[model samples]
Target chain A: MTAIAQQRKPGAEAATTRTRGASSGAAGGGRYATYLLPAAILFIVVIAVPLALNVYTSFTNWTGVGPRQWAGLANYRQLVHDSEFWASMWHSLALVAAMAVIPTVIGLLVAAALFDVIAKRFGPRLASVLRACIYLPQVLPIIVAAIVWGWILDPQYGALNVGLRDAGLGFLAHDLLGDPHTALLTVMAVLVWFQLGYPVVIFMAALQRTDPALTEAAEIDGATWGQRLRLVIVPQIRPEIYVVLLTCTVASLRAFGWIYALTSGGPGEATQVPSYYSYQSFFTNLDVGYGSAIATVMTVIIVAVSVVFLWAQRRHAL
Target chain B: MSAVLTRRRPARGKLARHGLAKHRGPAAWLVLAALAVLTAAVLFPFALIALNAFKPPAQYSAHGPLSFPDGFSTGGVSTFWQTADFGRALWNSVLISGCVCVLAVLLSILNAYALGIGRVKGRTWILGAFLVANFLPQEGLVYPLYDMAKAAGLYDTPLAVIIIFTVIQGAFGTYLLSSVLSTFPPELLEAARMDGAGRARILWRVVVPVSMPTIGVLLVFFFIWTWNEFFLPLVFLVSNSNQTVPVALGTLQGQHIMNPLTTSGAALLGVFPTIIFFLIFQRTLTRGVTVGAVK
Candidate 1:
């Protein structure tokens, strides 16, 4: 449905410049071009210039202090052998699994069930209410989500442990975020919870375009819900599935704020991701050059993934 | 169509003869149970925070972590406010998010107008840069921005956080508004120009009035994004008085890592405004999932 919505809108304004009379049109266009100035200036100062400076600083020994000395790929060389860099990279991969793969799979199942069975038999109103409930967490700040989970995983008095003990599963209770063995897994679970709502909402939007008659006919034909979802629903929502996957992957790549609040990349760096690691190197460790290197590498990875996703989408779309 | 089918079914007495309960009973139960559990999972943490925020510290520590408070009290919230200097933090956050909302929305109108309807040269490059900038993580720019802010004497100030949030959030706002504005009817602009309306007059009188709903949606999103923003504020604002709610809560977390009541209270303080905003604009937010995710 959204793909269709996107298709309906023309790509760019093609005739606005010439729609007016010829005499004053050039002067009018010049004045309109001035409208882009403020945004351009702000973007240049805040984003483009800083990013260029970041690349430049990665090659120097700038330590958040005075002048810089050019060290020429030394930071990149150090990053090659850096154990923490490699470890954080591994953590990011794990995060991609937790935040992207698992959420997409589960969100699809929940959304399908909601649309096919729940809404079909009951009512759309009920399904929407349920959708809103599941989507509640997405609107919250990531930092707040991490803090709430931090409280839940608090070793001494977390609700998670409290709930486990209350349910007579005390053996399942442990220092979820304090023990290195389970720290990363615990963080992953919380991040998964944070990401669950997004894909569900996206899929639900896509499902609006599905013909209920087809689902009803498939049902009368003795097709199980799973078969119907596989044979009918998934194909119809492939574009949205790609949308969720790409956006979630990009989100996981940019992960930092919440992880820092949750673990501070702690329990001996068990939950350290590239973004957090970069932050540590910059702010805490005061190693700006190495930090910039970590950041530049992260940016490259993100941009690469985005490019691949867009390329793939273009091919499939065409 | 489904409504018509359902209405005709009861008139035909098909429901009574067939007894729909045979098919709907177990399936409905299962779906309801699953949805109930999901709702609980999503709301449990907020329930915990709301419950714990009201408990006095002594009673909070005496009881189980998941236990309900013995009685409601404002002690924890007041104590958290004093402990974390949340008044100033709240003021700082309000100022930052408010300015960001206004600036981002205003700049987006300009940027979107130029790119969306003006047919300006290089519009493609400008839109592409803004869209790509939206995906670039703050981590990539944090170090350089920190240095730049410090050098410019804007470090540890609300103005620094405000400007950074404005720039970052404004980019997304521009992207969203441009998509919405690009669909504006060209005939309307022609009609306005035929009546001798200038560019400025047409923008405020025609474009803005027609796009108010979309602009309203962007306003809500930008405010929430700025208000919930953590990383940039953490990097830019270092002083106690300068911190936003989230950053202040962060600092308080490090200080009172062991105090659940205080931390939970502080967390509620940090999240209260966002919850209010979401409740007020819940329809817009839920509907926006597609726009936000797909874009």
Candidate 2:
């Protein structure tokens, strides 16, 4: 809420309150309702119809080309016992750690360092240049990123291996995306590298809004950097932290483009995330019904997570 | 010259903002060095791509991926460029993304104008629903959309992808933009009405012009997100001519994955435009993320 300085009212009333009170009436809704028509059409056709179709298809047996037969809860029943399904579900949590938890942790440290040291001590110009470098990966489509990374990590002639061989560390080189042991870890690292900039950017912005006086007082009181981060900076930007965690968590759960281009759950389904798994079931396995079920389940879980997160965000805002 | 370092209150007298003058020493240099190294690490792959894109495949194979290019070669770039049909892919991407951005922004403004400024009946529920809708993963919608597109005779068309993304991205844009616009100055709207302006005139003349910065931010996001999109494009765009850059490069990642030169060339192609975009919109890009986050 911007301070409505023009307000003649004795105390500050929110701009939002004034806007709402002044603009709204029965005629307002009736008149403006026409503006929503285009979006409503798009929403119904593009989001609503497809979503309803997906859920309904989950209960029926149909290949991509075929007539449907009711499968009832059979797909769900099978998924409950399916180890691969469970494994993919587990992989999502690992991705959340990589994409959300680790990035937020690293981003906080970096954002703080960038804000306190680079922005304040040196200059914001140098700090933002460094921030841009960290954020550079985000501009690439995941496929392009995965392609480059896949090349770098290729077992034989890839950059990492060739460089390693030259450095007399050839023995350490392995098929990073092919071998099961390293595949998921490699994927996670790529995600971390891709996602790190988001939180760094957000938290740094969040820090800008924080009361600099508190930080100044803490430093003058002889508090160490870590102590200042913990007690002063973190709490001040707690809301942004929650937002970052929530968005990144949602992004990780929908993680597909990286898995698709990097591994396709490959070298024997080693890096199979749920999205990729659902893709395989739909296109490769030709199990559209089963795929729909997997998709519906994933959607349900994500909606649940987002609803809870948004609720928490709303409460925290108050 | 730097306000951040220069801002001071003499009445307080004992301190500088961030206490920079007192703390200025080797510590600042150390932080700069650390940040430089981290930035280099993040950018290392891009540096490698630039280094290798100019080398011929055989030269790259022999050079162990570290040596400077042998007097500037374009063999790798031309090879991948021809093979990928990247020109067509680039055109397709531009077309689709441009359509999505404009259509989505228009839809967003209209939707947000109603929900935010008009304060329509049950606007809270509508906003909440839109928020949840924005979070729905593309996976659930893919197969049915695929099926429906076929039925509607729209599969493999750029229009199909454009239409779908317009709605999804527009919904999200609405959710974010509504929050930004809800607090729009009522005085401006009322004043416009006093001039005998109607709803459309007021929205276009009053709301949009005032909210240009936020709308600019949304346009940048829509373009990047649509351009970066892979799944729906890959699924919907089956024809070679219809495929976007990411889909073309992604689908063919297998054939060229082994040849380090061609892969680097492809990476360069896929990456250079983004680099340019980042350079151009660096400020807006950084600020855009926080807009949706904090509010």
Candidate 3:
């Protein structure tokens, strides 16, 4: 049976080659091969090679120096017992929750308000200016944003505390970054502020694509504003919702720079996300094998979540 | 009869419009007010930075919070250049960012074409791989790549920065460009083929020309990401001479522990190029991200 299947594949290949040749006339398959070479080289050298090396390193006892020895499942087993790794994983998940849910909710409200309320009164120029202002943080370097926020959130001499005292809201003014309990929340707030613009922009674009005629029709039918929104707007921008969710999820998982710049996983590992944990293992601890294992797991989680998202998207399309 | 009919019609129209217009009244103003409040919240820190950047060091230190600058001077700017290697750092940033943009754009265009137009087998798999690769955060591979760069003798060189930037950046570029490429009209490519054009000819003539807007978007996005990259350069580029602006600014902050004014000066200088670039290409940059998002 296997031999028969192989024989049948050869006949299919011959037919395909004949058709392909006839279609191309005289240029042959070489042109396509040539066109694909540069891309193939780039993919291999930059992407494929590094990825393969990483996977290999994950299975070894390499300390980023000296000879790498194959250790198979040991690294994976160790990761299962690593409390810091688990803590970091939870921290990362918490960050993702904050990053995904808050910005999305706020962005939806803002976008909905912009379309239903602001669009009529505000000129387009003003609307554009508002958008630019919101997106400024996103365009600025993350380090810069982190630094600016650091100054604002500084404990003693910071502007935020100064203003709070001036307004007699001193109780609200604590050491936001320096405190272990508040560090993660403060970082989350900064993340939400910086990322709010992304969802706003996407939601606005999606909202604009929604048919105003349908909305008008709904309005004319004596539907309340809430009913019109539920019946007309949300359904139209569903794909943008998925896109925002996926992008935010990934962004949250990859949180590093701001954490590095502001907290450095300080106050006793309070803000240590998985990415930072991975960095610590490799750089600070000189434990490459363990770090690679953590990284491999993260890669798997990211890929798995992304696959689920794309599947959902496909299901929605169907 | 005509006058009576006109008066009744106008009154009915006004009565009918009143409800919709009334619904739009207070709630809309409330949104504007809320937005004004949010804008103020967001703008306060940025305002502080700008205000401090202009003030003299003594005034900045001595003045009360939110106080106006005593006087404006270019002393900070001159001091930044003199005290720090601001010139070299700025040059290094521009060079690295420019090269990364060119390399990432070129690779992405080719890869996007292959995935989009070439009818390649496993195109979806390739795309999936790239997406997964993108999610592998920078810290994960930094050490390994650093070791590899050292082994290959590219460490502490601009080549090291360029290579690392191009490699990591290509992931997003591929994602953005492929999405853009997928939107190109298939009929146009079919027409090109029907005219006896080869794949290369079709790509160069039809696919590229039609995809310029997306390409422009990718260039700006890639440039921004490359310019803003910190971790890879921090780990890979060991020498001070090879330090990019962000790293240099970080170094200055660390070294100049006492003088908050000097640190601010350095930070201002470091951010100047990006501000200028943003001002100049603000329209394209805004449109690019929006286009990427919308699509």
Top lDDT model? 2
The digit string of per-residue lDDT tens for model 3 on A1-318 reads 644897897687557545543554344433444555665676676656776677788899977778999999999999899787787888888888788888888888887777666765665566666766776677777776776677677776667787787788989889988898988888988888888878887888788878665676566668887888778888888888888898899888877777777888867888887887887888889888888888878877887898898899879967
For model 2 chain B, the run of ten residues with the poorest summed lDDT: B4-13
Q: What does candidate 1's lDDT look like per residue over A1-318, in tens digits?
A: 654667655443445434532433465657788898988788899999999999898999977888899999999999999888899999999999988999999999999878766776677788888888788788887877888888888877888887798899999989988899998898888888889988988999888877655555555568997899999888878878887888899889877877777888888878889998888889888889999999999988887887788678768777
Model 2 segments more than 4 A misplaced: A1-23, B1-19, B255-258
Least lDDT summed over 10 consecutive residues: which range in candidate 3 chain B?
B254-263
Q: What TM-score would chain B receive for each of the candidates shown?
A: 0.88, 0.92, 0.86
> Which tens-of-lDDT digit does each residue in B41-133 have in candidate 2?
899889889888897666776785777877687877888889889899999999999999999999999999999888787888888888888
Best by DockQ: 2
lDDT of 3 by residue, B161-268 (tens): 897677667767777787677556656866888899977788888998998888887888888888887778877766778888777665554453524455455556
Model 2 residue A209 CA deviation in Å:
1.1
Residues B108-156, model 1: lDDT tens digits? 9999988777757677678777877887888889888888888899988
Error of 1 at A69 (Å): 1.2
Model 1 stretches astray by more than 4 angstroms: A1-31, A166-168, A217-222, B1-25
Q: Provide the overall lDDT of each model, using Cα atoms, as 2-decimal numbers.
A: 0.81, 0.86, 0.75
How far residue A119's Cα lies from its native spot in candidate 1, in Å, is 2.4
| Candidate 2 whole-model C-alpha lDDT, 0 to 1 | 0.86
Per-residue lDDT of model 2, residues A248-295, tens digit only: 999998888898878888767678889999998999999999999999
